[model samples]
Every structure is written in C-alpha cells, then in structure tokens.
Target chain A: MPYELYYWDGIQGRGEFVRLALEEAGADYIDVCRGPASEGQGIYAMMAVMKSKSEAHIPLAPPFLKDDDLIISHVANILMYLGPKLDLTPEDQGARHVVHGLQLTITDLVAEVHDTHHPIATSKYYEEQKEEAKARAAEFIDNRMPKFLGYFERVLRQNPKGPAHIFGDRLTYVDLSLFQVFEGLRYAFPRATAHLPTQYPHLAALHDAVAKRPNIARYLQSERRIPFNEDGIFRHYPELDKNAA
Target chain B: MPYELYYWDGIQGRGEFVRLALEEAGADYIDVCRGPASEGQGIYAMMAVMKSKSEAHIPLAPPFLKDDDLIISHVANILMYLGPKLDLTPEDQGARHVVHGLQLTITDLVAEVHDTHHPIATSKYYEEQKEEAKARAAEFIDNRMPKFLGYFERVLRQNPKGPAHIFGDRLTYVDLSLFQVFEGLRYAFPRATAHLPTQYPHLAALHDAVAKRPNIARYLQSERRIPFNEDGIFRHYPELDKNAA
Candidate 1:
C-alpha cells in the first residue's frame, strides 16, 4: 500500500520536509488531506487518526505518515524512518546518527524561522504580532541566520566524501531538506539573503545541484511544488526582510 | 569506560533531561563539563568535540553523549539511544517509535518554555526584552501550557496499561523527563501553575510518583539536581508570570 501522508493542504510548513524526501525518492504516497472526504481522505481523515482512541500511538500534531500498520510523526522521526527505506541515508550506523543530528539541527533552524514571524504567540495572527516580528526578524537575520547557515556550511566543508552533499559521496535526505531551506529563506528574506551565494558558497552550490536533479527538477517545475506564501512558516513581509542599510 | 555526557556546567537547561535519564537508570556516566578543566573535562572538553575535525559526527550544540565510538546529540536522539540500553523503552519496534515520538513532543514543549523568557533574541538578555516576554509568557500560561499539558494528560489517560505511567506499567525515561518538566514549570511559574494539581491531576500524580522513586528522590535532594535559577531555560520573573487575574 502507498504511504498516507497527512498534513495541512495549503502550506509547505514542516510537512514539506517530509514531502521533499518522498518526491525525490519517487515513492508512491498520497497526500491524504488534499483528497476529497468522499474517498475517505481530507482533513477529516487526518483528524480521525489524530483523535483516534483505538490507536495506542497518538500524534500530537499533523505531518504524520502511515504505512500499512505503522504510524510515525515528528518530521525528523518520520524522515529518519523513511531515509533508510528509500536509500536516502548511509549504510553505516554511525553515519545514520550523524545525518539524523543534521536533520534535528534543520528542525531547530525551522523553528527559529517560524518564530521570526510569530515572536509572541503561534496562536495569534501575523498582523497582531507584526511589530514584535520586525524586532525578532532583525535579530534573526543578524545573528541566528548566519550562525545556523555558517554551521551547515562548515559541516559541508568538513564532509570527508566531499562538499557536494551534506553527508557521504551520495545524496541524502538532509541535502534535499537543505535545498528546501535555501528556497524558503531566499523567498522569505530576499533582501536579507541577497549575499548568500557569496557568504555560503557550499550551501548555494548544493542548492543549485539539488534543483537540477531529474525527479526534483520535474517536481519543482510541475504544480507539485507549493508557492511560498504569507500563511507558511517562511513568509515574506518586506518590512521584516530589511537588511542593515 | 562509562558514557561521557557533555553539556553546559552551570545550568540544567536541556542537559537536565539527559541527566535525569542517566540518574534514574543508575547508569555510569560522567558529566564532562561539570568536571575541572585540569582533567580536560570542562566547557573546553565539550567545545573540543564540537570543534573537532577528526570526528564525523560534529554536534551543533551541547547535551551530546559519547558511548565508545558513537557520539549522539539532540536530547530526544540521545534518549532514544539510551532508552533501550538503559531498559527504559518497550521491546517492540512500533512501541519504541511511539515512545520516541512522545519524547519529541516533550522537546517541543521545552522549546516553547525557553521562549517564554527569551521571546525575541536568544542572544539578548531577558531584561532587554521584558515587555515582549511578558506578553509571550501571558499567552503561554493562558494557552500553550494547558494545550501541551492537556495533550500529555490525554496520552496518560488513554494508555492501555493505565494512567499511572506515560507508556506501560513500568516507568520510562519519559516519566523522568516529565517529572523534571513539572518541577521546572512549578519553579518558573509558581502563581501560573498553582491550579495544575486540580486541573491536571494525573500529571501531578505522575510527578509525585517519579519523585518518590528512590534514585530520583535522592537525585532531587542532592547537589546534582541544580536549583532553578535565572540562568536556566525555565526562569522565574514575577512580571512574566501574570495569569488572567
């Protein structure tokens, strides 16, 4: 059976990380929430699992995956499970843990990115927290962004296999996730990230390389790739994207 | 050789979650950063691993565990590795994944708690962002706290074994971590959490039970259990603890 991926229909958000891995691997999966309820799919289908009392494993939030009898949640946890199955990770146990660590770090950066737009409360709207967001974004662009990007760049440079991939000689799910992060940041902080090509040469190169992959290129050019919008974790607010002038 | 845990010496922070697991399991481990630099076991020792060129698994931050040749970071990742070795997780693969997912949920809660004091910039001091933090903490107390706590309470209530433990009949590292979360929240927001005992009776009971565990009880009263202070993730600032009243 094809895996059932349950997430919000509109935004890329955290679900995109899981989606990218599936897309790149040419894995057969259904975006459950995107389908109609008449077919036993949609938000209600996803909610049924979330609210299910029969299942011992309960998901705290969405972006959960179901394969036959097994269910998994948390982007990193789900990706870790899929990575090996899809041949997106290394064969060695130690190398697998390193890739998992990188994925967790990406999750950390994503959380910080989400906070830049919603500094005070996730429940509140962006307009309500616009002022605080401006200040938060300033600090993020100045300090946190460089810190995280630089760390990834350092990891790439230090990779024994080469700087082409975040891990060994072959492509891993982490490389794909990094490509998505590069896309989201460039879209969200156009002005703030204008110099990324020069500042993060390895990351820029990896991003360019991932975009050229046959499966990923087809997916990106097709309607499958979601547009970055105000509703997503990485949202563009010109006021919040300003760099020091 | 015993396991080597590298974390910040002064604060419990994220490291405490790992420390609690080790303490509860009665595992032989060294708090690397807590020892003196003369013996190559202070902040420098932790920094050395972070900056080391020889190791393939470079940790992005602290709270990394070194077991023989393997080095694992991220609290949940380390706990997942330690869970089975320490006999804290179920033997079934599916059940183990559920436990790991639950631990990841706790990690999510802890991150939100940290943001209560550092709402804007983590690099900036709490005093510099007092106003923003006050607003953030208000929402956390009113909305996020109850939302997370309620989720865990539901998980407990729905457990097939009973509500006595988070998973099965025997205690797990999750129980120990939850106990720490409870202690930290109580210390951080005394007034805000005064009604927790009544509102979340199961969690309160779990907290009490974990404390009554002989090893854990001794750890709590010992010097190893660092007191919650302004430096830690959960800090008590009266101005940030105001509830609806």
Candidate 2:
C-alpha cells in the first residue's frame, strides 16, 4: 500500500514539511484529502479519528505516515522514520544524531514562527492578535531569525567535509528543511531576508542546490505543491518584515 | 556504565521531565549534575560537559541524555529513548506512535508555558518582558491552558480501558509528563488550577500514581528532585497569576 498522509486539505502548514520529504524521495504516496477520489478531511474527521473508538490505533496527529505497519507521527518523528528508508540521513549514527538534533532545532524555529502569529491563541485569528504579532514579529525578524539561520549557516560553514551540506558532503532531510526555512523566511520576511542573504552564503547555496534537485524541482513546479499563502506557516505578512543589519 | 543525564543542577525544569520517567521505571541512571558522592555529580562538572567542545558532539542546550553510545537531546527525543528502555511505551508500533504524539503535545504545552513569561525574547529578562508577559499570560490563562488541558483530558477520557493513562491501561512516559504539567501549572497558576481540581480527575489520578511509584518517591526524597523555583520553566510571577478564575 502507498503511504497515507492525513493533514488539512488546503494549507501547506506542518504537513507540507512531511510532504516535501516524501515527494523528493520519489516515494509512492497518496495525498488523502486533496484528490476527488479520496475523502476530504476536516477538523471533525481528525477528531473522529482521534475520539472514535477503533482498533485502528490512531497516531498522534495528521501528517503521520502509515507505510506497511509503522505509524509514525510528530513531523520530526515521521522524518526520522523516512530519513534512513529514503536515504535522507547520513549513514553514521553520530552524523545522524546531529542531523536529528538539527531537525528538532528546526521544529523549535517553526514553533517560534507559528507563535509570532498565534501568540495569544492557536484557534484565534492572526488579526485578533495583530498588535501582539507586531511585537512578536519585531523580535522574530531582529533576533530569532538571525539566531536560527545563523546556527544553520554555522553548521554549513563549519561542516568538516565542506560547507556544501548541513551534515556532510551529501544531501540530508535537514538540507531540504533548510531550503524550506530559507524559502519560508524569504517569503515571510523579504525585507529582512534580502540584506542577510550574503551573510550565510553556504546556507544560500544549499537552499539553491536543494531546489535544483530534479525530483524536488518537478514537485515545486507541479500543481501538487501548494503555493505559500496566509493560511500556511510561511505567510507574507509585510508588517512582519524589517530591514536587516 | 550508567546513563548520564546532563542538565542544569538547580531546577527541575525540562530535565526533570526526563527524570520522572527514568525514576518511575526504576531504571539505573545518574543525574550527572546533582547526585551524592557515591552517585557522582556536581554543578561545575555538568556545566563543563554542556559547554565543552572537546567531545565529538555537543547539544545546543542541556536536558540531553547519554545512554551508552546514544547522546539524545530534546526532551521528547530523550523520553522516546527512555520510553522503550523503561517499558513506558506500548508493545505495538501504532500504540507507540500515539504515545509519541502525546509526548509532542506535552512539548507544545511546555513551550506555551515558557512563552507565558518570555513572550518577548528568550535572551531578555522576565523583568524586561514583564509588561508583554502580563498581556500574554492573560491570553494563556484564559484560553491556552483550557484548550491544551481539555485536549489531554479528552485523550484520557477517550481511552477505552479507562481515563487513567495517555495511551491505554498501561502507563507510558506521557503519563509521567502529565504529572509534571499538573505540578507546574499548579505552582505557576494556583488560582486557575484549583478551578479544575476534578475536571481531569483521571489525569489527576495518573499524576498521583506516577508520583507514588517507589522509584519516583525515592528520587523525590533523595534530594535529587529539585523544588520548583523562579529559574525553572514554571515560575510563579505573582503579577501574572490568576487572582481569581
């Protein structure tokens, strides 16, 4: 059976992170909610899966991968499972552990980005907390962005093999994630992102390299890859962008 | 060789989250930051290990666990490692996924609690962010606490066997974490927490059950379990607490 990815129908929120990895790996998978043939998912469907009494044994949340018997949830956890199968992680345990550490760091950065908009409540609208978002965004652009990006760039520049990949010479899921993060920050904060591009040349190169990969390139151009929108995690909130130092 | 848990010596913050599970399992481990002379630990030694670059790998922050060759960082990841060792997870893969999902949810809640005080910037002092923290804390107390707590309560209530554990009748690391969340919230938001004494009674009972486990009781009484203080994640800033819920 093909991998089953359950997530919100419209947005490329957390689920897209998992989707990108699967798509890049050329893995046979189904986007459950989007196709006409497949059943659409809403919050209630998600709740029913969680709350409904079933021997089905529900995974934590959407974006869980059911390949054969393994049910992996937690965006990072799913990636951890796929990393080896798809050859997205380094073969060495130490390198793999470091890559995992970096993935968890990305998880932190994503959470921070999500919090900038949903500072008050996850269910509440971004408009409801615009002022808080403004305050939070100021910190995000000036402080958090550089801190996370700086760390990633540092990992790239300091890579003993070369500055080409995050872990070592070869591409890993983190390289893909870094591409997403760079794409996301650039989309979400163009003004700040533009000036800071040259500072992390290695990271910029990795982002470009990942984008240029044949499978990922095709996925990006295909209708399957959702466009970045306000509904997604990487939204172009002009107010959040600021001039970089 | 014993497992070395490298973390802050002062408070039962994130590290304690890992400690509770390890304790509850009665697993043979040493708190590398704080332990008796026979047990082997000291503050200076822990900090040195955290900051030392001589090692092949270094965590960006503490709460990193070392089991033989495995040096796992991140609270959830460490618990993921311990969950299996301690039999704190289900035998089935699907069940393990649900437990991991619940674990990640706890991770989200912990982040929210941290944001209640550091809504501005992690680098800034609580005093510096006091004004913003107050506004953020209000939203958290009024909205987030209920939403997260309600979700966990639902997970418990939805369990087929009973509402006792996160996954099923058998105890998991998530149950140990639920205990910590309750303790933290009760300390940080005593007024608000009291209002829900019986709301999540099963979760409450689970918390009690985990705490009373002989190993956890020994750890608590053995001067290893640090008291909640201002330095930890769940700090009680009187101005931020709910005077009356």
Candidate 3:
C-alpha cells in the first residue's frame, strides 16, 4: 500500500518538509487531504483520522504519515521515521541522532517563522496584529534568523565529512528541510534575506545544491509545489520585510 | 561514567523535563551545569560544548543530554532517546511513536507558553512586551490552553488500556512531561487554571498519580527541583494571567 500523508490541502506549511523528503526519495505516497472528497480522501478524511476515538494513536495535528498500521505524527517525528526507510539518514546510530536534532531545530525555526506574522494570536487576522507583527518580524530578521541560520552554517562548516551537506557527504532530510527554510525566508523577507548568499554562504550553497537535485528540481517546478502566500506560515508583507541593521 | 545532562543552572527550564525522567528511573546522571565551577562543571562548561569547533554534534541550545559520546538536543528528542533506556516507554514500537508524538505536542504547548511572556522577542524584557503579552496570554487562556489541554484530556479518556496513564498501562516520559506542564501552567497562571481539576479531571488525576510516585515525590521535595521563577519558560506574570472567559 502507498504511504498516506495527511496535511492541510493548501500551502506547504510543515507538510512540505515531509513532502520534500518523499519527493527526493521518489517514494510512493498519497497526499490524502489534497485528494477529492468524492473518493473519501480530503480534509474530511484527514479529520476522520484525527477525530477517531477508536484510533489508538490519533495525531493532534497534520503532516502525519500512515504506513499500513502505524500512524506517525509531528513533522520531525514523521521525518525521523521516514528517514531510515527512505535512506535519507546515515547508517550510524549516533549520526542519526544528530540529524534528528537538526530536524528538531528546523521545527523550532519554523514555529518562530509562523509567529513573525501572528505575534498575538493565531485566531486574529494579520491586519489586527500588524503593528505587533512588524516588531516581531524585525526581531526575527535581526536576531532569531541569524542565530538559527548561523548555527546551521556552523554545523555544515564543522562537518568532518566536508560541508557539502548538513550531515555526512550526502543529502539527508535535514538538507531538504533547510532548503525549504531558505526558500521560505527569502520569499517572506526578500529585503532582509537579500544578502543571504553573502552572509551565510554555506547555507546558500546547500540551498543551491538541493534545488539542483534531479528529483527536487522537478518537484519545485511541478504544480504540487504551492506558491507562498499570506495564508501560509512564511507570508510576505512588505511592511514586515525591513532590512536588518 | 554517569550520564551528563547539560542545561542552564538556575531555573529548571527545559532541562527539568529530562531531570524528571532521570529522577523517576533512579538513573545516575550528572546535572553538569548545576555543579560548582571548581568541579569543572558550570555554565562555562556547558558553553564549551556548545562553542566547541572540534565537536561535530554541537547543540544549538542547552537542556541537551550527553550520554557518553552521544549528544542529544531538544527536550522531546532527549526524552525520546532516554525513554527506552529508563523504561519510560511502551515495548511496542508503534506505541513508542505515539508517546513520542505526545511529547512533541507537549513541546509545542511549552513553546506557546514561553511566547505568552515574550510575544515580541526573547531578547526583550517582559516589561517591554507587556501589552502584547497580555493579548497573547488572553488568547492562550481562552483558546490555545483549552485546545491543547483538551486534546490531552481526550487522549487519556480514549486510552484503551486505561486512562490511568497516557499509553498502555505504564507511565511514560510523556506523563512526566505533562505533569511538568500541569505544574508550570498552575504556577504561571494560578487564576486562569483555577478550574483545572474540574475541567481536566483525567489530566489532574494523572498529575496526582505521577506526583505520588515514590521517586518523583522525593525528587520534588529535594533541592534538585528548581523553584519556578521569572527566568524560566512558564513565568508568573500577574498581568498576563487573566482568568479564562
């Protein structure tokens, strides 16, 4: 049976990290929520799984993978489970832990990115929290972004197997997720990340390398790749895209 | 050699989650940063590991576990790594993933709790973001808290084995983390959580059960359990603790 992946129908959000991994590995999987409701595979279908009291392991939110019997939740958790199966992780156990840590760091960064726009409340509209968003975005551009990205850059630099990828010499799920982060940041804060290549050369190169991968290259150009918009986590608002000091 | 856990010395912060598991299992581990500086263990010692260029697996922040040569970061990741060793997880692989997912959900709630006090920026003081914090906290109390706590309550209610524990018939690290979350929420928002026992009886019962565990009871009264303060994630700011509507 094809692996079933459930997330929000629109926008990449956290699901894209998992999608990218699947796409890169050419894994057979169904984007369940994106399918038509007529076939019983849409948002309602996804909700059925979450709302099922009979299900022993119902996930709180989406981007969960259903492989036969097991239902894995959380983006990082799903990726960690899929990594070994997809061969996107190293064979060594210790190295796999480090890679998992990197994915969790990405998870932290992604949450921060979501907060940049919705600083006050997820229920409130962006216009309602525009002033607070501006402040949060400025701080994100100046402090949080650099700290997270720089840490990744340092990791890439310090990799004993060379700085080609985030870990070891080949592509891991961390590299794919970092590629999504780089893309999201650039799309969200064009002016702030205008000098990304100059400032964080290692991350920029890693992004470039992932973008050029045969499968990832095709995935990016396909209709499956959703465009960044105000509805998504990394929404671009010109007012919130101030250049970093 | 004993397991070495590295985190900031004063406040429990994220490290307390790991500390709870260690204490409950009666596992021999060193709270490295909490030790006296003369003993080659303190904040400086923690920083040395984070700042070490020679170490390939440097964690971005603390509350990391150094089990011999392996360094595992992030609260959920650390607990997931230690859960099996401490026998805090179920023997079934699928149940283990479910428990890890629950822990990751706790990780999300904890991050949201931190954001209540620091809506604008972590670098900025609470005074600087009091207004935003109030707005955020109100939402957290009204929306986020109920949603998260409600989900966990349902999980317990829906447990097949029993609602005595989160998974199977045993107490996993998730229960311990949830216990910490319950304590933190009560400490941070006493007025807001005044009806916690009435509203989330399952969780309340679980909390009471975990607290009564011999090792845990002793650990809570011991000096090792740091008192909640303004320095930690769940800060008690009266201005941000408006009662739920």
Candidate 4:
C-alpha cells in the first residue's frame, strides 16, 4: 500500500516539507486530503483519523503520515523517521542525530517565520494585527533571520565533508527543507532577502543546487508543488517587508 | 564519565527538561554550565563547544547533551535521544514515535509560552514590548492554551491502557516534560491556570503523580532544579496575565 499523507488541502503549509522529501525520493504516497472526498479522502477523512478514539495513536493535528499501522506527526519527527527509510540520511547513527538537530533548528526558524505575520494570534486576521505584525516582522528581518541563517551558513562552511550540503557531501532532507526556507523567505521578504547571493553565499548555493536536482527540478514545475500564497506561513505583505539595503 | 549537559547557567530555561529526566532516572549527568568556571564547567565552557571548529556537531543553542563524543541539540531532539537510554521510552518503536509526537506538541506550546512575554523580539526587553506582550498573552490565555491543553487532555483521556500515563503504562520523558510545562505554566499564569485541575484533571493527576515520584520529589527540593524566574521562558508578568478568572 502507498503511504498516506494527511494535511490541509488548500496550502502547502508544514506538509510541504514531508511532500518535498517524498517527492525527491520518488516515494509512492497518496496526498489524502488533496484527493477526492468521494474516494474516502479529504479534510474530513483526515479529521476522522484524529477523532478516532478506537485508534490508540491518533494524532493531534494534520501533516501526519500514515504508513500501514504507524502514524507519524511533526515535520522534523516525520523527516527523522522517513530519512533512514528513504536513504536520505547518513549511514552512521551519530551523524543521523546531527542531521535531526539541523532539522529541529529549521523547525524553530520556521515557527519564527510564521510569527512574523501572525504575531498576536492565529485566530486573528493579519489586518487585525497589522501594527504588531510590522513590529515583529521588523525584528525578524533585522535580527532573528540573520542569527538563524548565519548559523546555518557557518554550519555549511564548517562542514569537513565540504559545503555542498548541510550534513555530509550528499543531499539530505535538511538541504531540501533549507531550500524551501530560502524559497519562502525570498517570496515573503524579497527586499530583505535581496542580499542572499552576497550575505549568505553558501545557503544561496545550496538552494540553487537543490533546485537543479532531477527530482526536485521536476517537482517544482508540477501542479503538486503548491505556489506561495498569503494563507501560508511565509506571506508577502509590503508593510512587513521594510528595511532593505 | 558522567554525560555532560550544556545550557545557560542562570535560569531553568530548556535545560530543566533534560535535568528532570536525568534526576528521575537517577542518571549520572553533569549540568556543565551550572558548575564553577575553575572546575572547567561554566557558561564559557558551553561557548567553547559551540565555537569549536574541531567539533563537527556543534549545537546552535543549548539545552544540548554531550554523550561522550556525540553532541545532541534542541530540547525534543535531546529528550528523544535520552528517552530510550534512560529506559523512559516504551519498548515498541511505534509507541516511542507517539511519545515523541506528544513531546513535539509540548515543544510548540512552550515556544508559545515564551512569546507571551517577548512578542516583538528576543533582543528587546519585556518593558519594550509590554503592550504587544499583553495582546499576545491574552490570546494565549483565551485561545491557544486551552486548544493545546485540551488536545493533550483528550489524548490522555482516550489512551487505551489507561489515563494514568501519556503512553502505555510507564512514565516516559514526555510525562517528565509535561510536568515541567505544568509547573512553568502555573508559575507564569497562576490565575489563568487556576482551572487546570478541573479542566484537565488527567494532566493535573499526572502532574501530581510525577511530583510524588521519590527522585523527582528530592530533585524539586534540591538546588539542581532552578526556581522559575523572569529570565526563563515562563516569566510571571502581571501585566501580561490580565484576563483570568
């Protein structure tokens, strides 16, 4: 049976991270929520799994992967589980832990990115919290972004195996997620990220490299790859994109 | 040699999660930064590891564990690594993933708790972002907290084995972390969390059970468990805790 991935239908959101991994690996998987409701797949079908009291391991949220009897949740946790199975992680156990650490850092960075727009509340619309969002976005662009990106850049530059990937020489899920982060940041903060090629050359290069990968390259052009939208974590709003060099 | 756990010296912060697990398991682990500088363990010692070019697995932030040569980062990642070693995780691989998923959800909630006091920027003081903090805290108290806690409550209530623990019949690292979260939330939002016992009885009982554990009870009274303060993630700011029954 094909692996079943459950997530909100409209936007890529967190599921895209898992999607990227699955797509790059050419893994046979069904995007359950994106499928037809008549075929017993969609948002309601996903909700049923969460609400199923019969199942002892029901997930609290979507973007969970259902492989046979196992249900895996959280992007980093899912990636860690999938990494070994997909042959995307290093062979050594210690090195695999290092890759997981990198993915967790990316998770932290992604949360901060989401807060740039929804600073006050996820329940409130962006317009309702526009002033606070501007303040948060300013801080994110000026300080947090550089701190996180610089850390990753340093990690890449310092890698003994060379700077081609975040861990080891070959591509891993961390590299794919980093690529998505770069794409999202560039889309959300075009003016702020205009210095990427100059400021973070290594990350820029890695982003370029992932985009050129045979599987990832084809996946980007496919309809399966969701486009950046205001509803997603990284949303573009002119007022929040202030302070460009 | 004792396992070396590195984190900022002063506050409980994230390190307390690892500390609770160690204390509960009666494991020999050094709280590296908490020791005196002359003993070759302090904030400087932690910085040395992070800044070391020789170390390939340098952690981006602390609350990291140094298990001999392996340096593991992030609270959830560290716990996931230590859970099995400490015999705090279930024997089943699938069950361990469920525990990890729960831990990751707690990680999400903890991040939200931090934002209640520092809504704008981590670089800025609470006084600088007091207004934004208030707005964020109100949302947290009114919406986010209950949503997260409610989900956990449901999970506990719906568990097949029993509601005595989060997963299976044994107390995992997840339960230890949950105990810390409850303690932190009550300290930070006394009035807001006043309904925890009645609203989330299972969680309340789990908290009580964890505290009653002989090792944990001793650790609570000992200097090892730092008292929650303004410097930590869960800060008690009256202005931020405005709306409470």
Clashing residue pairs, backbone N/CA/C < 3 A, model 2: none
- Consecutive 10-residue window with the lowest summed lDDT within model 4 chain B: B236-245
Individual DockQ of the candidates? 0.67, 0.40, 0.82, 0.74
| Candidate order, DockQ descending | 3, 4, 1, 2
Model 1 lDDT vs. the true structure? Answer: 0.90
Which number leads on DockQ? 3
User: Where does the lowest 10-residue lDDT sum fall in candidate 3 chain B?
Assistant: B90-99
Ten contiguous residues with the weakest lDDT in model 4 chain A: A53-62
Q: How much is A221 displaced in model 2, in angstroms?
A: 0.5
Real interface contacts reproduced by model 3, as a fraction: 0.79
Residue runs of model 4 more than 4 Å from their true location after superposition? B243-245
Query: lDDT per residue, candidate 4, B47-145, as tens digits?
Result: 999988766757788889998888899998888888889999998877777789989999999999999989889999999998889889999999999
- By lDDT: ranked, best first: 3, 4, 1, 2
Which regions in candidate 1 have their CA more than 4 angstroms from the true location?
Answer: none
Please provide, for model 2 over B103-182, each residue's C-alpha lDDT reduced to its tens digit, 9 standing for 90 to 100: 88789889899998998678788899898799788888887888788777777776778777777788888888898999
Candidate 2 residue lDDT tens string, A185-232? 888888988865688888898889989999999999999988889998
Off by over 4 Å in 3: none
For residue A243, model 3's alpha carbon misses the true position, in angstroms, by 1.0
The TM-score of the first chain in every model comes to: 0.98, 0.92, 0.98, 0.98
Which residue pairs show collisions in model 1? none
* Model 2 CA lDDT for position B155: 72
